[model samples]
Target: MIEIKNLKKVYNDVTVVDIPHLTIAKGESVGLVGNNGAGKTTLFRMILDLIRPESGEIRSNGEVVAGHENWKTYTASYLDEGFLIDYLTPEEYLYFVGGLHQQNRAQVDETLAALGDFFNGEILNRGKYIRDLSKGNQCKVGVASCLLQNPQLLMLDEPFANIDPSTQFRLKNMLKDANKSKGITTIVSSHDLNHITDVCDRILLMEKGVIIKDIATNSSTLSELEDYFGVGQTLGSVPVAGIDEEENH
Candidate 1:
């Protein structure tokens, strides 16, 4: 379980994230939805201890996250390409990540073989550095790497942003099956409402750093999200007319 209380972050005198209280139970799949600057990534950073919050605290499996390293044993996160080693080949990177979790090369190779369809023949043994791979392929590598250790808590930010349609569907199915069979506690942020709705059991709509709506995924969830983000309706905050006020002035 993950528990957050009174979490907060500030930059340039603006609150980027402020959550009074929240909890994610074990095996739950959650989707975070928001426009740019809604604090999705920021929140993830705080949870992973990549950034310090001004106040409050987060707990993972009854262990405090901040100033502690125990949670790292069970938590695996992939937020962006920055989380990957661009200088290494995809295979090398996977071995490195697996090593951190005590997974040997042979074990890592076995895991990669099972994900053949997800890789689509473009990732492993390509003999190209991750830096040279296309963004979509790099994303595939990153996503696959996160699943290598079979972490109990997995977090990915915008897993569908840069990928082919066929790969996207395959990835979604992979995540769904992982969640069902292993009951991995999963959290993902995405701008794609349909994809998010399809993979997650719960969705949180964030605006200006606060989750204003929490809806359980169902047949109507996609349309509901579309209506909320539709033009003329606020995506949480920021006056529409004032968008260009700073530039116009």
Candidate 2:
């Protein structure tokens, strides 16, 4: 579980994240949906303690995330290719990541083998460094490595982006099964509302550095998200294509 209090991040005097409080429970799959510059990734980075916040604090499983080392033992995240080592082969990167947890070669191999479906046989033994892999495959490598750590808390930003549809589906199923079987706490941010809603039990909508909506999954949740992101809301100058086709002509 994670707890955040009065969290705020600033850049050049502009407030990018201003979360008063937020809590995610253990074994819960929470999705964050927000448009570009919506502060989702900034919040994640702050949680991982990758970016020092201007104010406030975060605690994971009762461990202070800032200025602490214990939380790393239970946390794993894949935000972007920045998380991957481009020079190393996929296998080499995974092995290196697993070794951080003190897992041996056999353990790492077993974990990769178990994720065969998620990897789709394209990642391992390809004689390709991570930088050489396609962007989608690189994303897979990053995600698979996170899962291999057997993390108690998993953080993935845009897990569906760049992935083909079939692999996207498999990734969702893999995440669901992982949460069901191991009680891993998952935090995912995606622009794809459908994928986020499909895998997450709860959803948070962010805009302008604040979580404007916290919704529990239900039949209507998808539609609600659709409408919010759809045209006619006052989200400032974001044009909706085909909203009025006749006028453009």
Candidate 3:
């Protein structure tokens, strides 16, 4: 339940994000795929009100996000390690985040228990501060913290990066479950085409601060996207497996 109208963000002398209008309905799984400097993270920051848009507005659940606090209660995002409390141990940080949502230590532990597969036994009781963990482990911590909040709207930037393949597969399932079973509105921006296609039903292709193509994913979606990005099988690279193969994983 998010809407953007005339949204634009600029830096110095260059426009980075210039979306005119966009909408994401409740329980929708949307993917944003673009190369570097495509303004995906900028758009996400404006949506979260972490940065003010130069023009236009973003509304969550019909309320202007620019000057509102209500949406914060239902929204959870992890853009980078910057979102983590690096000095705190993983357990301490997660518990602290859970407390912010009024969840007790017991509840936080319960949530962590359910995420054991996602964590792959590296997060809890590690005796290591979040800052000491690898980038992929740090990503796991951030994502786990978000899930502990049980958010209604979840946004992740480049979630598939800096993680192992097994963890990536688990993360995709988690997002799918959140959208289909719990009805969470999910938005993720990623560079990996196969992962994004497997996780999101709809895809937004962005370039030079604008949404160039809004595609409803289908059997041929991956190939079509590859063609646009010039990464087609004709380029002497192995073609990624299709959606059916994604499920098999």
Clashing pairs in 3: none
> Which segments of model 2 are wrong by more than 4 Å?
232-249
lDDT of each: 0.86, 0.86, 0.88
- Displacement of residue 123 (Cα, Å) in model 2 is 1.1
lDDT of 3 by residue, 48-129 (tens): 9999988999999999999889999999999999999999999999989999999999999899999999999998887999
Report clash pairs, candidate 2.
Answer: none
State in Å the error of residue 79, model 3. 0.2
Q: How does residue 110 of candidate 3 score in lDDT? A: 92
- Cα deviation at 103, candidate 3, in Å, is 1.0
Candidate 2 TM-score to native? 0.91
Runs with alpha carbons beyond 4 Å of true place in candidate 3: 231-249
Error of 3 at 72 (Å): 0.1
lDDT of 3: 0.88
